[model samples]
Target: MQDLELQAVESALTDLVDGERRWATTTLEQRRDLLTRMRELTGAHAQEWVDTAVQIKGLDPNSPLVGEEWMSGPYVMAASLGVLADTLDHLAKGRSPLADVKFHDVRDRVAVNVLPTSVYDELLLSGFSAEVWLRRGVSRAAAKAEAGLAQLDPSRTAGIGVVLGAGNIMSIAPLDVLYELIAHNRVVVLKLNPITDPLLPVFSKVLAPLIEVGAVRIVTGGAEVGGALVQHDLVNHVHMTGSARTHDAIVWGVGDEAVERKRAGDPKLTKPVTSELGGVSPTIVIPGRWSNADLKFQAQHVATQRLHNGGYNCVASQALIISSDWDQKDRFLAEVRNAIAAAPERAAYYPGSDDRVASALESYPNAERLGPGGGRLLVDDVRPDSAEPILSGEYFSPVYGVVEIPGTGASFTAAAARTANEVFAGTLGVNIIAAPASVKELGAAFDDLVEDLHYGTIAINAWTGVGYLTPTASWGAYPGHTIDDVQSGIGVVHNAWLMDGIERTVVRGPFRPAPRSVIRGELALSPKPPWFVNNKTAATTGKRLTEFAADPRASRLPGIFASALRG
Candidate 1:
């Protein structure tokens, strides 16, 4: 991998950037045309993308992750950059889909995503409930991104976007790339993390359409490469989904001179920076009464969120906040253990998941052990105040060590909320789990929790990671943030619409997840998940979802409708 010629790629990138700049500054129709071409290519080459994932990207042939990466990965990259929609039509309006289904028109007129909200809606929605997907345009958000760059502000500060790729997740790099290139209109130089470098060529393949058109470029190397990236004259905006230590090095550059610059409150230089840095996100349960099914369902939901992606995600709920007197915590914890035991041991992508787990167990010395497929740790009430730094340490293992919250001292919700506000590491997501009883009693508090958390996405019972899987949801740092104190990385990613006004988007799902799920991480033995309707039909269903998202009313609907029938 290291043998790849560097100079040739760099030269190619210079040419690519030139082309993108011309397109960005040019007319809207041209940009839209390029984006349309991107969409066509994505649909045309969908199978090739799946093939890349299977053979080159180390994906399981049957895992939902493959199909997801195909849609959100290469497909959404075009949706973000190739089709930049910075301007809005006057009196913007459009038809809306039923809300219960995951559907939204994020673009002007109508912009169906390669993977629309409907896939999730129909997949997750249950009962006879009807859904209406939102019909919103990108006018406000586009206006916001274009807001401060007026001619009057001569110093329109620009930052070179440094996307430090996640070694484990292929989608993170593309998401970072899009946010920098399209959402903020900044030039991006993406540094592939060492772990995932083997898959870089595969990404380049999926992105070939955009790359040929000069939308983005890729570079490969190690920490030295990353350091060089931050220091590059072209890079001003820095975003990474890695360890807190990595972030500290950037905040206060590493060596003596760097530390001096950081201490002085001004580095040798400064530009806008933002990130959803890694951290131990919290999943909370409000004390509540619930049916046995509800208790089991909510517990499994939280467990799967943490267990997803091998527990190396920025948004995984590292902390499980159970009400002091919830009585059901025992029943819930057991189910969580069962679910963790069910998830396959994913390759630890984060640099130090094992060490992080070791530290947790060292402090408590009583972490529970589970799992038939991989090494795992499960704990209960080890250290609510262990004098240990959960946020400071980096972990690369599948361990769910619990900390008990006294029911009387502070309600579980209050305690969990405090942790979220003050916890260390990155702020990506938080899942608040409560039975209907709790919601009914403290609905206002639930709303308050949503507003109070600094996370990028707040999911009630369902994991917010599901939101990232939904193209309709916007993924990135929370609103009202600047580079200096970016709770998460700057700007939004995976948002095809590029909503100009939204700082962070909150997506709420039902307490009990619907039967159709693509995640194969938790509560399952084989790659075959019970939620996929008929497991054999995953690929077909995936294709239909992609098609339906592209043009819901197109005559192609028959194929998608037929697939749904077959499923």
Candidate 2:
């Protein structure tokens, strides 16, 4: 490494040495105060953060689609600050964060209701609910007993951690830093991805409280800096949000020797590492009778799943799974095509996006380029057993394919689940869309299907991204993956409840939007969610929601409701 780069890394480490000790013994009240200040600063700079991201991605500032940046960037950060502060408040009082939360038995496993914890959540995110399912053999009492940092031995001194930030979403790095500092009681040195290094000013300002206290440090560079930081003697733990290839390079040295070392179960870096590498996630659609409106609305929903962030998201739906026997399959497919074509156009800003899209086109000659500038590609009617790369690879672009299973009802759902598990690349998340009536018809079979799928986060009648946005829900790949095959990574973050032994998070939303939802007997009051790409008022709603998340009040409800209803 160059002298200056090496000095920078050394300085960061040296600064954090004392921080690691100071933070480990810091009182919970002090930590909560830092979070409160962080939240205030984040809200103050939220607009600037969103505007910077908008310019970086070449998005129109006037377009509603700027809401994507608002929601994914500052909104999530602000919400997470509040949630983590609440957890610390409970810990300061010597109580479990999940003390009053409801727990229920699902197939003999304990599932804790983590959402709607406050009246604000019920109003702001009505019709949405989330539950964190404990890993098998974890009883409810054990869950409460092990929740938060208080459970650790008081004299145990926390060490410094190195966090590798993600490029796609601006909030990911800061959120990971928060998790490391509060949840694990570790000081963090967060290295921003080169692609998002421009946001260093915004991050520094927003995270000033932590930085001033030496509890966190933000640095920028490519692999060389990250490599040096992770392997540094002072760093005791490592967390990253990126690809599996990158993770392997850091854990096992790169090249032929790296391959052999992985094979031999030996690693270059001996410190504990946790990551959130993405995979080729699937969107499974159950067969159901639907009105024309249902077909149109759901088509847009699926389109949003694939096209959000121009399909650069780690959890972006890459495979569309449907039952061949559904009579409306043709209509639904047509609607999806229309939705993809009609969605707003945006730049494919991520590195190598064009090449990934081109690779998909080369692999499937019949792929359709739907959006303007030919950036969106969709391959329909893909066979489950086909050797196509799009079916199993995480393209991380505006490219997706459809696979059809031969059955209906519970049999098709079961087969689809099996195919997703067997054929897909990673276990990060999966989305299942079923009408309320269709789910009712399946009865306990629906619950059984959910329990059987081995994904970190499962969404029924909603996008898994919702699970990511919910600060309390655990987000990561299903556990049991070893470093040799670290598919979609090995650990979870953003779990504000601070509960351990988490298997996965299950999130459910209304099958239909607002008025239509009520008419269809879903009884949900939520309108078209602001996160949807097609929501016209998303930018406004997202901004208002961020403000509310920072400083929640009854007075802010009217404006939020008004903007959301318009969307």
Candidate 3:
């Protein structure tokens, strides 16, 4: 918005391009040092950042908002720093390398600088999922950068990189910027979403080094600012981690131009663009024989997926595609509604969430409202509804509705297969809550579901959001795309492993949980509940989770024992 800022951004891009030669030559050690400095600055200044996030956004430090603040708090901050360290350390020893991809004798990758902007204190109870992505992402970028340096195209002119950030999450912008720079070696000019612009001063403080290095800079404004940036002559590569609507507008270049472009096999602009647009994910509850414990654990798991982020995430379990005839289906739906109702009221992230919820009710007069306060949740008991039509609409509040349409003999399995084809939000994750018998009976069907589901990440008895948290999981829209058909996004993000993978990631966990439910106890937005397995004992559970994540298959017994013993 300022002339000086414009001048600085121009200068920054010029410097980055002028210094391209040194980019490949820049050692991983140097990059690591920059990341280290960023982590330290973020951790040290966590409180100020927290204060800024809270005050500027005027977000309540109660229930859901507090939990999100926790992501910015110490837990998230420390974890981000740790993962970053772990990633750098992985490269410090020269572990994995990927240099095969080349384009016109030019390397398109560079070391991405992950700026940790978490407020550690608030998130102490909750685990930081983004850390899982960032830590692994940095190392992957380093490896990519190493290979890119070898395939450098000295004559290739660098392109303008435009990044439009997400408003709900704190580190999304920084991480996206890091990816564009480190993953593709592109210089970046990031535009802050207006919703969180108040935190600019603090973010400016945290990202000073990126600005100082002339690799990244931030510009603040609204739609006009974004439109101008996208339209800028120097800008070439565009990236946004927000709404599908925005991506559509950007790809087609909003208005009459967009309409014209759609008519052809082209967009308003032909330039290469990438995005991490939201998804309307589904959680498939495969029916099978299970004890009460299995039902409880899986029900809670589904509830957590929808409840996280105040139920505003693109990947939130929008459609509970289940076998309507499964005997446990009604019970599962009941428990899920109860869990959602029991959940405390959350602050809606999207600006018009309240209106959206109200509109949804008005649109579907039959939708039943739940929770202590009716606004907390609304159960829209859906019956096919013209094959998953609710998914076409975006609901912001924690509404745990059921679509209990009939399934054939493999009621659950068959329903999952059917819904997988119909749901909106191309990016999705299938949550399978099943007993061992069910897994076996439906393993082949599950395999096909994995092959068939359009989701980006598939989780088992847990929220797909965990995939986003795991750091190693590749996050992106489903890959089969053409300009007009592009659903979720064009590329992937937070993939630390850098596996050129085609298979959808499946996160498998225990069927029935040990009493210590992380989400209910420590990770809850507020004080620990007495029944929360985590409330009575967090240390025991934390250690178990740590071990489980470190080594799952090999270390199953302890995990089982811990779960059985209630941690």
Candidate 4:
């Protein structure tokens, strides 16, 4: 992609900033109407958006697995836009969007229940729940102080911001734009990741209203375009969802010179920046006596977490922590391997997946290749202190490693959480799967487990992606990370509730997810969750799910179930 001329780039940014000034000053009523239009436009163009993504990614357009595109593409975008519009509508009526939200004190922090925004939300995403924990000393009155800030902030000035999008997830780029435009009230210029630029037209079309009003602009190019926009004077703030290497290159320079600059505490750009970079995420499995069926079910849960998006996700479970003392440990590992073997092999579609997988195999020759055509890797017997490839590496592929500590209950939980925080090199997301009995056994210590895990989002008996799908829950690395030791980069996004000073989000769900339930499962959640890369009806079912979410009706429920069953 050729970089646009400097003059043209500057002009576009100026136009966006001017439009953003108007956007920042809009009354709640006007802002609500604008977002309502955005939701409608996005829903209308949903199909084209998914289709383009499927085609560009070389997936079968007619296949149900195309649902991956729908969920990651139009579905997430439409869902997020709808949530933002609802927040604005509430604010226009002089009510806090989180007026009915529940909160409970946990030691020094307050955990705010941010899910189930409406009855429809609970009904649609059954059995799933989310809570956002505020940083210490942040009172209830100040919790959502910025929720009603459609008008200008007296302490802050309105200006244009730039978003450097991620190519792996279709929802990321547009969602980043939404965070800037709706939450922060900044006009935005979103530069598409060249790898996924084929969907640019679809994005432009869906965002036509915003484009016409000059509230947003869509740009296309590679590193040169990103550098120009990042260094431009008119851009007041910058947000990016990419790699830590990319973040360093953008903040410091590149090569040996950049390393020295970083060591000296000097950066190229002084403007404020926020980012969501990749990490080696972890999942902890508390030891407990379990029936074979329960073992089999949780194994599938762990497999789906790793194999989702071909393991391209930043939140994918890369490190699996278990207790060596558990009697069921061998059975669980066997079940995990069986599940991975039975699942269909997905193409290593991401740019570096093949090379990463190959490198991992060479480093750990004992690694077992699971699934058809060697599409998945399972490296077992990884000791807690071993310098294994999976321990320090972010494979970014359909690869997972298992580490066993010696203990049970609180001892195991503490060791696992500490290892996840200190050894993994990221505070992005972590998962904990424990039976109700096990949690009851630990009692108050369970709270300690939740508090000690230094991650932006934590999932209890669920995948971390569930937290990502919940809009009110903040999505980013944990706070207190610096540019010099930038693990998982920095900053938060997708916080539709307009909260500030967020520490982390915790989500809890049923450990067994009821039998034959639509939203829960041992083998799969519902009949077919599009996240399973092997789901044959993913495209159609995903499309149906998105439509139902966009405009929920009792009549649409049967069709969604039918489509899900077909896959």
lDDT of each: 0.54, 0.89, 0.57, 0.79
Q: Model 2 over residues 1-567: C-alpha lDDT tens digits?
A: 678878888898899987777776677888888899999999999998998898888899999999999899999999999988888888889888888989999888999998777888887777899999999899999998898853244336568889999999889999999988877777899999988988999999999999988889888888999999998889999999988888888999899979899888899988999999999899999999998998998999999999999898999999899988999999999999999999998888999999988888888888888979877888985888635587667899999799988899889988988988888888999999998888999998788789888999999988999999999999999999978889999889999888899999999998889898887777689998898899999999999989988888889999999999999
Best by TM-score: 2
Q: Candidate 1 local accuracy as lDDT?
A: 0.54
Query: Which pairs clash in model 4?
Result: 64-537, 64-538, 64-539, 67-538, 67-539
* Backbone atom clashes (below 3 Å) for every candidate: 36, 0, 22, 5
TM-score of each: 0.76, 0.98, 0.77, 0.93
Ranking by TM-score: 2, 4, 3, 1
TM-score computed on alpha carbons, candidate 3: 0.77
Q: Write the per-residue lDDT of candidate 1 for residues 58-163, one digit (tens) a residue.
A: 5577765444444445444443443233221111222111112232343232222223333333432321121111223444233333322211121232434567
Against the true structure, whose lDDT is highest?
Answer: 2
Tens-digit lDDT string for candidate 3 (355-404): 87777777667666766557654455666544444666556456555665
- Per residue, candidate 4 scores C-alpha lDDT tens digits across 1-567 of 243446657778978867866665667777667777777777788888877777666765666557777787777777777777788777777777767778888789877887766766665555667899989998887775555453324124358889998988888988898888777777899988888889888888877778887889888777888899999988998999987888989999899879889878889878889999878888899888778777987888888788777788888898789888999999999999998787655567789888999998887788899888876889896766536668776788988899888888788888887888778867899999998778889998888999999999999988888788777888999999988878887788998877778899898766764454333333324443456555667777778877865665788877776765665
Instruction: Output the better candidate (3/4) by TM-score.
Output: 4
